[model samples]
Target: MKLFNFHTHNKSENYGIINIYPEENILFGKKYSCGLHPWHYSENYETALSQIELLAKEEKIIAVGETGFDPKSPVNIDMQSKIFVKHIEISEKYNLPLIIHCVKHYNELVKIKSQLKPENIWILHGFNGKIDIAKKLVEQGLYFSLSENILKDIKKADSLLEIIPTDTIFFETDDKDYNIETIYKFVAEKYSMTLSDLVKYIEINLKIMGI
Candidate 1:
């Protein structure tokens, strides 16, 4: 069974290598969620934002960002929110699902989202929060893209797989050390699903989410 890689930072031939070059998709054999990371936030956000817009317009750029608020770090929270809203606006404008990397700032995310009321789908990558928070996000109609660590609780995983609507679910391996296919295989096994079927399922979800 093949897998759909929803988000990755690796260089790729499909999506141009982000920040490294433009007009070249030289890194072959992988799909991508190429975008600016929030931690790499810059003062020249508007300039970088323009470049990001152009990059996102590329055919291989399947997702808008690894962008979102990070509250704990030293960066000014106001500045972070401003930059993050830009990514959200781009995702909304382009009709692409956002690949979010949120840290300690879900409430602020909630506020920004309320004001924007984006039609574009928002996905939380590498999600491993508690069940209540997961439920809250699900209630908000957000998708949670799971990873290897989320598989430890067999019962919880099974429950989530069974109860969560298929269109709101996804999987990824942002992990550079492990191959994505292997990660897919592991998750697929947990769900008692074929890997190719899983990929198909996610693609269907992407469509439902307007990606």
Candidate 2:
């Protein structure tokens, strides 16, 4: 079975949404999620948004983001949010899922979701947050993409997985230098499910999101 990576940074990946920043050159013939990350936010953001919107027209561009709030970023929270909302607009227009990168902003993320009520799917990538926050986001209809951090803390992964429904869950390698199968293997063992079964579950989730 081909293991699906929900989000990743490696441009050479054959089967996943490879994240592309607005300033980067697009490598043709690969699935991608493009956005202007908060870390790269700048005064010329309007130009960047124009570039992102243009890229959104490509058939290979499957999603919008890796864009969201980062309290520690040099950019202020308000500007970060403004840029995120623009990405949301692109996602809505393109009819694609949104892959989010959030840090210490679950409350604000939830608030925006409630306020906008976007019809497209919103996925939180590389999630390693509190279970309560995960549950809260799930309540707001947001999905999650987990990475290698789950392997580092089995006990926490067990608790977090129990609360997050299978249909709302995804596995990714992100920027980490590890095999995606490792994440799949860990979850399969944790839930006492065969790897194939877990794969099927995630595939179903992807379909439900219209990916």
Candidate 3:
């Protein structure tokens, strides 16, 4: 079976979707997730955001983000929150699941999520936070997307996998050079499931999220 890499900037060697920033070079006929990242905040943000609103309607776009909080970034937190909310609005308008990029601001993000109570699914990509935080986020109906960074600490990865419900979790290559198959192999070993079972589990998530 082909591996499902729910998020990544690079093209999939196996069957999976790629994330394309609106400003990046575009190609035809490939699956893509489109949004304005918080890291891209600038004076001309309104202009960029207007463009995203248009791109969100494009047929090739499957999801609506990599956009969310990043408190440690040089970008103003308030601006990030504003733009992130706009992305959420766009996601809702288009009925696309959101792929988030949070960093050291889970609480703030959770607060906004609580206030918005959005119907569309929200996915926190590259999650490596404390288990308690993960539990809280999961409680709020947010799904977690794991990337190759988890492999840097096998024990932690095992523990996180233990806590995270298999059904709400997803694996990705993100922007890393690692292949999605490697992530699948490691996760299957951690869960003591066959590679095919892991694939089936993620496929179920994709279906649930309407990806």
The candidate that wins on lDDT is: 2
Q: Model 2, poorest ten-residue lDDT window?
A: 35-44
TM-score order, best first, reads 2, 3, 1
lDDT of 1 by residue, 1-211 (tens): 4455565555442322122322345344444454567777777777777776776676555567788867653468888888888888778777777888887777787778777888888888877766666676777778877776566776676666554566687766565435666656766676688877777788788668655
Better model by lDDT: candidate 1 vs candidate 3: 3
Task: Tell how far residue 115 is off in model 2, in angstroms.
Answer: 0.4
Mind giving the per-residue lDDT tens digits that candidate 2 earns over 12-63?
Answer: 9888779988878767777888887777887568998888888887655788
Estimated TM-score for each candidate:
0.79, 0.95, 0.93
Which portions of model 3 miss their true places by more than 4 Å?
12-14
Q: Which candidate has the highest TM-score of all? A: 2
Clashing pairs for predicted structure model 3, backbone only: none
What lDDT does candidate 2 reach at residue 149?
86
